[model samples]
Target chain A: MDSIIFLRPTRGLAALNLRDLWVYRELVYFLMWRDLKVRYKQTLLGASWAILQPVVQMVIFTLLFGGVANLSSEGVPYPVFNFTALLPWGLFSKALSDAGRALVNNRNMITKVYFPRLVIPVSSVLAGLVDFAIAFGVLVLIIIYYHFAPGANFDFHFTPALLTLPLFLILALVSALGFSLWLSAMNVIYRDVGHVLPFLTQIWFFITPIVYSSSEISSKWQWLYALNPMTGVIEGFRWAILGTQSTPALLLIISTLVAVVVLISGLFYFRRMERSFADEI
Target chain B: MDDIAIRVENISKSYRIGTAPERYRTLRDSITNAGRHILAARHLAARLSAGRSDLARSPDPSSHSTIWALKDVSFDVRRGQVLGIVGRNGAGKSTLLKILSRVTEPSTGQAEIHGRVGSLLEVGTGFHPELTGRENIYLNGAILGMKRVEIERKFDEIVEFSEVGQFIDTPVKRYSSGMYLRLAFAVAAHLEPEILVVDEVLAVGDAEFQRKCLGKMSDVAQAGRTVLFVSHNMSAILRLTEETLVLEKGRLAYRAATPEAVDYYMAAGFSDAGERLWQASEVPADAAPFQPLALRVRDPKGRVVDTARSTEPLSIEVEYRLDQPITGLRVGIYLLTMRGEYVFTSFDTDDPGKFEQHSTRPAGHYVSRCTLPANWLNEGRYVLAVNASAFHVKRYFWDDHALAFNVDATGAPGKHWPEPRLGPVRPALDWMIETL
Candidate 1:
């Protein structure tokens, strides 16, 4: 028997069994592809829903937060700034909801056949990325529109830090997947987990600096705010694409650590609870 | 030993079932229980060390806690084998399959399946009613671990087998039940996984479709692949598989050849034997006039019995409490084979002279016997579920679980069992081995 390894501050966190996941990667890809096709199959807009989600949200944030609330867009245009952050954030939100209920939603599959239970949530997270890419295309178009097509002072240019955008996106993916694993496993046993997910997401949005700039927050509470994990991801995106000076470096470091902690613990909790899912669901 | 495609070590799964409280517990109860398991563990240990039994007790007290499913189970299946799992409902057959598929992990032990697995636990699994048949086919195939290329290669065959044709592009919600079952089974069967796990979803299809599926499963098994099939249909189990495992109430009750295992499963009656004969809460007051007061199946001596050879004289004795004497009454015993096949019906009207006027005061019991001559039934597990009607079938009483019995084979096995082979009648036959 292998030695017990705990992945959390609290004891009894089960092993993640990473080797099994590696073996089932092909299955994981197929499941993700299946989810992507089915999600868009009969929808009226097809893939357009992806571009529309963040684009609509960007318009709302630019009007409400930038206009009435006077939230700073740093030196960048509010539309471009909000769209970039919302692109990844929207993907994270979709992943959270989809992965959170993947097990319960597929009750027939869960009770009848056997496959790695982890595959369900992981595939949900992966499938949401396709939507993120579609939304990202819209963000680029909006950036060009504001910078060059109109009478605007903004100059669109790529920087070396643009490469880190993928890393930040990866961080957000892990963060959503981590929380989703816990939610999906819990949703199988207690349906209330699903009922509370929307409220949870609403509160989580406030904690992440998705709407207002993180620069407005005082430094004393930066470490605490960074505990939200998504803080680092959103701030990093605004910094990379919008070229914001106040990137909240200290908050990004602390939130990265926090995200890692939540992810590892979430995965362990999920894997431990996974064994009973089929029976109970 | 041949390649062990699947190895199941001793595994047990238990569910902690808690009744819904009359009212949700207050925050105080939550804090108390959480504190006991976490915050008080060290203090409770100290209290135990100090010899204070009451203070040292653990908390999170659960009322009437019981395990709802599964006990130690172990088995192995070689490559290129089709193993049938047969049991009544709630017998843990599905639970075992879920464990093997790793959709759920075993509670106590481990199961190692060596190859890719594709499972069809029920018809239309992983299908969204809003999704077209074509979309569902891909979703189900992916869920079964099949790549797009693999599904593409078998796509035409699947469509042909299901006979969905133009309807394949339509959402499955509009499809008939037969079409839904066909498409679901076709995707699962054609997925080309090394190991195929199927439940009794095919039984939902039409007779011709069910036959086609059974034939396909036979072909798959013959191609040196592994299969784990779970079904309540004994004939399907016996026809498609060589090895069988029987589970009863989450435990491995028996395992052997297909026929013997199915026989054991059938012999174990479906109803819970421990339940009381009469439940006041279960009986409906609306069934007052035609209530089933008593039920019994017996031999000539009137002793209750449930097993007999095909040639033995047998009878079903149904005793009913009639509120009033009624004429033109029809008392019939429906003979159903274990596979739910209706063999034949025997009614009192078959013998016109058997009816006689007999009255009793107020409410009283009456016995109606259904007698069958020797060698009438085929050799199989038969149930004597009975029903009665009055006033030319105006209305009556029906008891689904009246009684069930098994009819053993009295015939010989045509030199297979080293005994004299009897004819289909199971009665004395004259020999004809003369000058010819």
Candidate 2:
């Protein structure tokens, strides 16, 4: 075990020590476990609250946007369309806020010990999965509940298309991790990112086609709308689960491209700022 | 060369306070000054506003932008050598440890280590009170750079040493503070890496716990592992380390056997013997509510002197002015030896009646004095450090380098024999030489 480790100042995006990140994968798992463990202290209320939050949001959107504004859900009842989008959207938003604050919240570990700094934010992003799984179960129940009721007719069968559900879920996480990487790193130097996060998430929610189907948006701006990666994630989730009318090939292509680009750039930006974190944070 | 466990070559670190939290950056500032000005421009603006009036004011004394925490410091430690590092506060001791642990990068140069490294900057660096003692051991072990198998292998020993086996599953929040420190330290002690970087771990805990830590550290040293130990506890250094490095003002001041290094390090704090004073400019801004003014030593003759006789009581006095009323303030002195080992500590309000009478000290000029009994100290040099702080609250001022004085043993017990005194204190004993 005589590994001669070398130390020096990192420069110019050369600090992306993915090997270091890989070496401490156990720490990554432990941190993720700790977050999950400490998060839900009261077991029943914790899981219930996780499902309760999205169900309440789905109801509000169905009543306000679905009923009052006469927004089209492509003939599917408003609740199923809205909740389907809410799953990925909820997962994405949680990653944005939670991952963004992970570094600042663990300043003790940063200033004290040596580990791959990326593990902190990355673990929080992944830990959002547990909450996502809880809410997803509720979404399935909502789908079945609406199917048997009057005037609400969508199915919840295990289709070959449902195989793509995990893919869209992964896509939502990729897009979140992208934006989160930038926000968390910058949050270390300038705390302005923390204050700006809520407002940005609010606007992002309106931009993504969460309340209404992507078919309602005018074609001229659809490409620009897909620039926000969550648009494709929400749209893709509806098609994969609900098997919505049209295939969103163009939307998927644009959204995936943007998410991959942001993730790569965010990775570079994070590594560049990684060296100063211990001192600056 | 092959036996060297760590090789640090010309390592240095410089911190720009501009980026640190001290120079808080708001969103408005970042937006308005986005690219046109970041560090350089704003620094110039700050200087221009401070003006040119105070020419005699010290330049770059910590607040003026840049500080080099370590300067061209280099060293090598053989595979089984335990090295001690001693320094005054801000002497770059902790910064050096930070660099070697890879917690931060050096601004210049590099270091190579040929073994698994474990750093204990503080006991329980990431212990969550919500976590059980058993769980915290695993979590804390992982954070301290221990592998999963390592923690699993040593789990039993850790619980046994901590002596909290019965309560291992209880949340550490419920543990007494003493129990908490014990459990945290237990995990750290069980780390059996080839190399260790420890910082003042003995500084916490009670006297018994400190002794236990000293015992554990000696065991580590005796086990033939390379260790870099930094501490202000001179006695512990003398006991555990064979060699020591002395750091002064961010530079390597001296290096030698532990005894010599400790003596030099302790004596280096002396600027004068009879009296020490701090000027208005010398006092740190944070010490505003209470500022240290002066410390003086006087002989039995009532004359301020640098040297005192062991046969007569000596008086030590501290003078200061408090700008505001304070509660629970304890103005105390720590008496130590030339090797920096503690003799005893005394506070002006240590007496219960005195503490009750002066529970709240009003703002004004004050003088606190105490006397050391005659025939109490042996012939040697000693150091006194002053502290003014409220319990568990704000620390107004502290000066470890406040004063150093000499004590002479004369006309005491066994004066006719002319034998050298053996320990820190010299006590007069009543003797009866009857044929019994």
lDDT of 2 by residue, B1-436 (tens): 3999999998888887565446546666767766645665477668778884443322234457687899988888999999999998789999999998888999888899888778878888889888899889989988887789989999999998888889999998899988999888999888877888889988898999888888887788789888999998888888889999999878889999999998898888677558998898778778878977899999877788888898999999999999998899889999988777788999999999999999999999998999999988988899999999887998888887679998977787677887886889988877779996
DockQ of each: 0.19, 0.73
Rate residue B59 of model 2 by lDDT.
28
lDDT of model number 2: 0.86
Residue B7's lDDT within candidate 1 is: 82
Clashing pairs in 2: none
> Which lDDT tens digits does candidate 1 get at residues A4-64?
2111111255668787676567667867876776677768989787777777888898899
Docking band of candidate 1: incorrect
User: What's the TM-score of each model vs. the native?
Assistant: 0.75, 0.93
Runs of candidate 2 with Cα error greater than 4 angstroms are A42-44, A156-158, B18-23, B27-64, B280-284, B433-436
Worst 10 residues of 1 chain B by lDDT: B272-281
Please give the interface root mean square deviation for model 2, in Å.
Answer: 1.4
Off by over 4 Å in 1: A1-13, A38-47, A149-151, B1-9, B21-63, B75-82, B109-118, B191-196, B256-265, B268-334, B337-341, B344-381, B385-402, B405-436
Candidate 1's error at B217, in angstroms?
2.5
